[model samples]
Target: MRKRIIIFDDDKDTRTICSLILEGLNFEVITQENCIDILRILDLHTPHVILIDNHLPGMKGAAGIRLVKESPRHKHIPVVFFTGTNNAQALADEAGADFVLPKPVDLARLEEVIELAINS
Candidate 1:
């Protein structure tokens, strides 16, 4: 079965690029520009993994990660922080992410990370 992947990013290009890359790898991608009511996305289904922008417009980098990590219903899904910053991986670690990938994410690396997360 294809893994469900939920992506949260404010940039159209980033979101679209990620959707395309993941789709090519056979992941079912569910993307959103707004994180206001992520509960709605949860209703659609629990993604096997989540890809969140390190710097969202309204929310702080780690704040959004905390909310998802703390949520009882959605907590189990592994999250990877994606950012253009040089410190992206550090931020992800601080935010308690399972992994972190530099933005303009390499599709090959992402596929490996996702597979590892799923297998683990």
Candidate 2:
């Protein structure tokens, strides 16, 4: 079965591009505009991985990551931070994210991260 991924980003273009790239790489991608009801979404889909932007609308991506990590049921799912932030790696580490992809996202790196996350 194709691995599933849930992506959250406020930028429509980012969401679209990532979705297309992941879909092309054989992942089942679900895109969300914000982190609202993230737990609900995770529970509903149970995706293998999640990609979140650090600069979301209401809640910051790090905070959203924390929320996911705090949840006992969904905490094991890998969460990756894909953002333009210069300190993306540090932020992701602080937020308990399994990985970080700096934007403008490198397709190769994205693919590698997803594969690593899924296999780890």
Q: How many residue pairs clash in each candidate?
A: 0, 0
**lDDT tens digits, residue span 2-107, model 2:** 9999999999988888899999989999988889789999989999999999998888999999999999999999998889988888888998999888998898
Question: Stretches of candidate 2 above 4 Å error?
Answer: none
Q: Summing lDDT over every window of 10 consecutive residues in candidate 1, give the lowest-scoring window.
A: 34-43
Model 1 lDDT per residue over 2-120, tens place: 89998888889888888998899889999887566665676677889888886677676566777777888877888888778888778788877888878788888888887887776
| Alpha-carbon lDDT of model 2 | 0.92
User: Each candidate's TM vs. the true structure?
Assistant: 0.86, 0.95
Candidate 2, residue 117: the lDDT equals: 92
TM-score of candidate 2 versus the correct structure, residues matched by position: 0.95
Evaluated at residue 76, the lDDT of candidate 1 is 82
